[model samples]
Target: MAKAQDKEAKAAAKKARKQASKERRQQLWQAFQMQRKEDKRLIPYMVGLFVLIVAIFVGLGLLFGSVWLLLPLGIVLGLLAAFILFGRRVQRTVYTRAEGQPGAAGWALGNMRGQWRVKQAVSGNAHLDAVHRVIGKPGVILVGEGSATRVKPLLAQEKKKAARVVGDTPIYEIVVGNDDGQIPLNKLERHINKLPKNIDGKRMETLEGRLSALGGRNPQGPGMPKGPMPGNAKVRGMQRTARRKG
Candidate 1:
């Protein structure tokens, strides 16, 4: 009986150890994946970073071969690595915190692969929210993810904005959710991409010409209501919309 009890205790310890090891490995994997994902230009960027770092150190080391510069430089490099690590940690934390929240779609869409004009929170009401429009071949797509009763009105307002520039361009509106009338959050982008392209260069050029006057405004408000701020439009085609709320 004592021997069986001891065996069970050993087994439990081993199991716990295995679990800890697995968890550590999973954390490392997640960290690595996050780093890789955020840095699509990983190789070149890192190489450039490393080269610059090495050059600085080489010059500094030559200038002051004494312990003071070397030690300080080592500390700086260590801190830089820590900063990179911390940045990724912050990003993952922000993402984890945003999961299942109201405006998660904004985060996902802003992080897409192309030059999309994402105007966020174009219109919002007590019960619904509307993301503003414009895209490349994708044309105008109003994305609403809130109560259907409220979203419809939000959609109408957004549609009106699109029509002013979209003219006869193919326009689509979709609500993000699993409800009977909504598109699931995960499928939102795929559905948008899968839609037929509606605008030609001539029309797109004309649309841009019309909307050019509307680009001087700021897209980001104080803090975005419930989810991610559209980051890429600043880098991508997301210029400011001229319209402002009174």
Candidate 2:
């Protein structure tokens, strides 16, 4: 009797998960449809990508005389190509919408791959000038976004504060924008990734604990929300799908 009950519970759980997944996909599709209305090039781009992928695969299959074996493979590869193109388009859309918005830097930092602790809006002013802090194996990175003149001072001040806590550890400063000395928004992740890894995992943990003592304090106001920007549900869905595929 207990074994039968367990089986029933497992079946019910599976059904619930399936329903949830179906609902999520529906939401993602609806969101994608709405975005498509504004992004006229999206469909054409995906179609082109699919055709290119299929052509390459089919050509290779014919050359190898494995048309039967590779036909299905071609279809699968084409679908994946389209899906990846969709994700890239969604990412570009999200970034375009986020550009010049307050807390945009924080949003970019949140999307960064790897285990970095991000503290947003650690300091800011009425003009939306803000400083965000990140701690990782690279040590401390202070990112300032807003007017360069105003943010320069903010970054300097934040650096001093962080240095006090992280004595001898590297503290890098970056300004996100398209100015002469600033890194572009799209390249922000790559820039962070390229930073020298000065500390190891154990040092990272110690640094995190030390910084945690600083606690949360928003001088201007609360930082940007921790995850994807509001109204970016479709982008979030695409990100999940891409991650799963990866």
Candidate that scores best on TM-score:
2
Question: lDDT per residue, candidate 2, 14-57, as tens digits?
Answer: 99999988876775576568658878998898888888878887
Looking at model 1, report the run of 10 residues with the lowest lDDT sum. 237-246
The model with the greatest lDDT is 2
How high is each candidate's TM-score? 0.48, 0.86
Give the per-residue Cα lDDT of candidate 2 at 18: 100
**Candidate 1: lDDT over CA atoms?**
0.58
Q: Give the distance in Å from residue 171's predicted Cα in candidate 2 to where it truly belongs.
A: 0.9
lDDT of 1 by residue, 4-97 (tens): 9999999999999999778655654554455556556644554566556656776787787765667567556744654454444434444444
